[model samples]
Target: MATEERNHVSNGEGDREEQEDEKMEQFFALLRSFREARDKRKHELRLRDHEEDINKKMKKSKASKLGNDERSSWVPRFEWEDFTSEFEFPRPLVVFPTPYNKKEDQKNQEDDDGLDLNLTLSSASL
Candidate 1:
């Protein structure tokens, strides 16, 4: 009877140990899930912050490029000058050369006309 009691006690202890081990495993699984969730939340927050920072930088860059303020606006210089009657006109920038030989050009025109007349007469005779 004593031996049976010892065996029963050892079996109970074994069962308790198994229950404790199962509980520890469940706790560790919950801890791992919580850690994963925390890491995911942190990553999402970081992405949101990075996106917001990029949007801010883009807005600033676009504002600078477009010159949204009056101080950054460009103004062209357009001053009117009053000219007096005594103001002399400037000389022409480009000068063309006169004909060098007008007689030679006239002789060439006469020779072309003679050639045309001869062609016409030869074609009529043919």
Candidate 2:
């Protein structure tokens, strides 16, 4: 009877250890599932926001395209014949002088010096 009692006590302790291990496993599985659900929710929110943004951009593009189409159909307010008849030959083509020529510039400088020398000689004679 004493030997049988020892064996029964040892069996009870083993069963208790197995129960604790099973509880720990269940807790870990529940935590993992909760984290996965939270992540899925976050991903869904981001996807919805992205879809809304794309929709808004598409709407703006369509509005702008409609405005452009309307503008393209516009006709000139004046008659082509009336415009041509009233137009005068844009005042005779005014030609601007070209850049200075090196030869002409040197000739002008020499002429100026000669005039100054002649003026000095005449003044001295007086």
Winning candidate number (lDDT)? 2
- lDDT minimum window of 10 residues, candidate 2: 115-124
Clashing pairs in 2: none
| lDDT (Cα atoms) of all candidates against the true structure | 0.84, 0.87
Tell me the lDDT of candidate 2. Answer: 0.87
Summarize candidate 1's per-residue lDDT along 1-126 as a digit string, tens digits: 999999999999999999999999999999999999999999999999999999999998887777556353568675455443466659856778877798998887875665553435565366
Off by over 4 Å in 2: 1-3, 68-126
- My TM-score estimates for the predictions, one after another, are 0.52, 0.48
